[model samples]
Target: MKPHLTLPIAIATALALAACSAAEPPAPAEPPVATETPATPMPADPMPATPANPSVGGAAMDAGKDIVTNASAAPNLSTLVAAVKAADLVATLQGAGPFTVFAPTDDAFAKLPAGTVDGLLKPEMKADLAGLLTYHVVAGNVDAAALTQQIEVGGGSATLTTVQGAILTAMSDGAGGITLTDGKGGTAKVTTADVRQSNGVVHVIDSVLMPK
Candidate 1:
């Protein structure tokens, strides 16, 4: 009993040979720790996708967002956005109600007459290029302060009526701005008018409107 301290039998044979040299089989199970994969979500935006408005080959279609959207017109009329897409007239200037476009920028087709905007963007003259572009449209809704008070009480003048019906006058250039005769007289001045659309109004003329 006094020697029972045989060191607890030499520490239980050194803890059974150190648990059989730390059992080498337990390490192979650690390979299950590698996981990372979860990321993908971004895509949704495109309709009339708005880079601007107007359709059909979209040739600068900027007739004041089709007169503010009266229905869908867009003939920013100049030498004609490539003759209104070569006469397709962008779905009849976006059809539906109230149309009043006097637009014409790009320096108003650079004041044509020289090859008249490439001869009305040829192609059998697309119905004379959409009848000289719906003769600069005018089915209704003529704004711009009632066209500058009807061109100052008619002294300056202010008449309109097209859709091919013809009869566009709207003059008044003592400085104020306004001019748009066409029925073969071809004038165009407006040089930027009301430009409100959604029903019609763009008066940004300069020239390029002849139809008689």
Candidate 2:
């Protein structure tokens, strides 16, 4: 009986050992699956800049505005503006004309004989004032670069026909400046150049240009 009992106990022990060996050893703790961190993103490129408009007569000259509007805003161009209004040329200048205007400042008008401006502003002198004012204007948009090119092509001097039916001579003043000779043989120097307007361009002069 004792031998039989010993054989049964041995069999039971062997069965328990086989069951333990077959069981998975807790999957080896899964090796702690390494969590990869996400990568950072990069930035984009910048844009190009635009050019700014130039200033005039202690005021900002807007390239979006017309010649009459711009001239009316300038502190030094008040006399010229008044003359334009008196001469009934506001409509003409404000029209769609890519004109080139040789604008004279208040100081330039002051250089004339005393009471000359006042006399011209009178109602009777309207036609005369209009003629004088129109003498400073050309048909198309002639900027400084175009004028310079014309000067170079015309043997150092260029003849510009004004809207007033008169010719004005443009030449280099031998000192890196432009000098304009009117129909009356008087000379005016360009103090400010390339003052761009929506309907035209302006070159401010030290003296007023006159017609015959």
Candidate 3:
């Protein structure tokens, strides 16, 4: 009797499978996962660059000090220091000038005819020495960049008015340096430049600048 009921039993089993599948609802399609794309990581900011400070007279210059003080600290400028003091121009140079000084080294002073510096340092020659010293100083802060710009604008030579009412000429040395010409037509090369001071800038010259 069991063998005779095989067909009806197979049909009943198939119907039961279909009923179970329909009742389960096919697992609801797994509910699409809301995947959010991760945001790109941002880069960190770069560090600021440091400024360059140049040395003069075998020592670094202090921008916190005035011209007279800074120059007095330089060993190579001893003659210049003495001359400044002898001329009684220390107070003037130390004041709020913003003057550009073409400072000559001791070697530069030596280049003059024998006893020239000694003669200038005499009490009776104080006025003359002051005039000569002032000739090396130009009013206002004239950095190398300013001199370069002026030279470019002035057709390769820039004329600067000095504190002594004399004209000084600045020109490029064709070797990435600067040269200055005084009223006496003497030219001096800037051995060191852009020496910052509280009141102005100092450009160390290899030779003393003489004015007519």
Candidate 4:
């Protein structure tokens, strides 16, 4: 009876130990190590660069634009632009040939006699208007530096043949400026020089040049 009782006691103890082992709860699962995601970097602002060309008529001039396109943007050139349109010379001024333009300001156009611009803009006077406007344009891109060099080379004056088939006399104004004498002896001083464009360069003049 005593030996049976001892064996029973041993079996009960073994079962209790097995139950305790099962209740241990997997060592708390190591607390799930938190992996932090890296933060995203922000982008920088995109700023535009400054343009190299100077402003004209209170508007910024872009060197990538052609002559007619640039001239149309200038406030001081509205009269000249209208005259060009009336003369049907927009296509010619916008052409591929590198033209040198002596651009006249609105004040320059105002110096003409009353009704001169209106008269020239008429349909019947298209040929005359075209001829008169072409007098302000030379065949090639003659910048201020080149014109100065030409004047120096020709002993203080240079002759420029216009697209209007007339001769223009370029001379130094004795004060580091250029003066253009038209065929009719009217003189125009270059107020602003070296206004660069895609197709050519322009020198803003205070007076309109005329052909003979």
Candidate 5:
């Protein structure tokens, strides 16, 4: 009876050991294999466009201000500024519209028939003065590239309609210089090109544009 009891006890112990082995916690799943994902590459920087000609009239053109405000900075444009004020065009130019102005220097105004500017400043001649001023402006901002492309498209000449409803012609005046022909067949050579303003662009012209 004692030997039979010993054998049964040993079998029970062996069964308990098998159950404990089966219940082990799966060795923690091998810690998920530690996979390392490669990092994404960063994009390259963009190349900046070439800058246009330097600002005109010994001052850098301010892109943050409107055409009128920027034009006021040019020492050579004082006469043009006075004419603009007298003609009441400051508000119009300061508005949201993007107007292209062929700005004339003081020397350009001097080229006008003597007393022409004085006469235009008169109260009764305001309309005429405004017309003349507007003639120098186009409805949209016309940059140097656009002007040159238009000239090429028009077989070496481009006709731009001014804000005053007059036609002005643009043509290459030899060696990459541009000349604008007004309604009266007078020409204004662009001494400086691409004077960027906030609301528009300005090309400093050697002569003021006149409308018929």
Candidate 6:
């Protein structure tokens, strides 16, 4: 395999070139603006705090039940339990978000070789930690049924607008499951679904979703 193949997919997703300029060969012209045309469904732009839920919860829900407590109750998520709290996202998790969180269990995070998690938790690394945490949350109330159905139809993909204001592309696994392609194109599989809460739903994944 090529050495570039080893680079994280998140990086690639983040840096994808929007376009490349070509040499100028003609005079610049103003683009056309259409006059009164029927509007059509514009696929979707990730989904930034939809109309149904326009609230932001940066810190008001710390005392409420959150991903940490929920993941903790499940014996298999002990590690994920630690990471969520460490990232200072427990409160955000409990906020009245209607957030669609793609949660990874403890064992899923263990897939990383070593030292990565430790380095990310350093005090100076708060920004990086926050980005990683928010990448797991889609800004609206997206249920599994909605996701799978989106794929089954020819949608082929749906973009999720992360709390960090980043986009994560999700595609179907073709086996009644969904796979999330991180900003860098890294994929995380949904292992469990519909872990409901007052604010939103949680879907357990077998791998951590990283941003590029």
**Which candidate ranks first by TM-score, i.e. highest?**
3
lDDT of 2 by residue, 1-212 (tens): 46769988999999999999888475655568788889776666666664455676888888888989999989999999999999999998888898999999999999999999999999999999999999999999998789988999999999999999899999998887899999889999999888888898899999999887
Candidate 3: segments with Cα more than 4 A from true spot: 1-18, 22-50
Question: Candidate 6's residue-wise lDDT over 1-212, tens digit each?
Answer: 67776576756655564222233356778889879878897886685753231111212222235555555566666666566667788887767787888877767777877988888778878778878888888877788888877666746988778898888877888887888888776789987766665677777788988787
The deviation in Å at residue 42 for candidate 3 is 6.2
**Candidate 1 on 84-187: residue-level lDDT in tens?**
76787766666555777776665667767577767768798778777777887788777667878977888878777788777888777777777777877768
In model 2, state the lDDT of residue 75.
Answer: 94
lDDT, candidates in the order shown = 0.66, 0.91, 0.91, 0.92, 0.89, 0.72
Scored against the true structure, residue 111 in model 2 reaches a CA lDDT of 98
TM-score of each: 0.30, 0.76, 0.82, 0.75, 0.79, 0.65
Residue range 21-115, candidate 3, lDDT tens digits:
88885555677889999999998888886456577777878888899888888999999999999999999999998899999999999999999
- Identify the runs in model 4 with alpha carbons over 4 angstroms from their true place: 1-51
lDDT of 5 by residue, 1-212 (tens): 57879988999999999999998877655556687899998988889885753576787778778989888888999999998999999999998879899999999999989998899888888889999999999988889999999999999999999889889999998799899998888999999988887788888999988888
The weakest ten consecutive residues by lDDT in model 1 span 50-59
Cα lDDT for residue 125, model 5? Answer: 89
* CA RMSD of all predictions: 16.0, 6.0, 3.8, 9.0, 6.5, 35.8
Model 6 residue pairs with clashes: 9-184, 10-184, 10-212, 13-183, 13-184
- Name the Cα RMSD for model 3: 3.8
lDDT score for candidate 4 against the true structure: 0.92
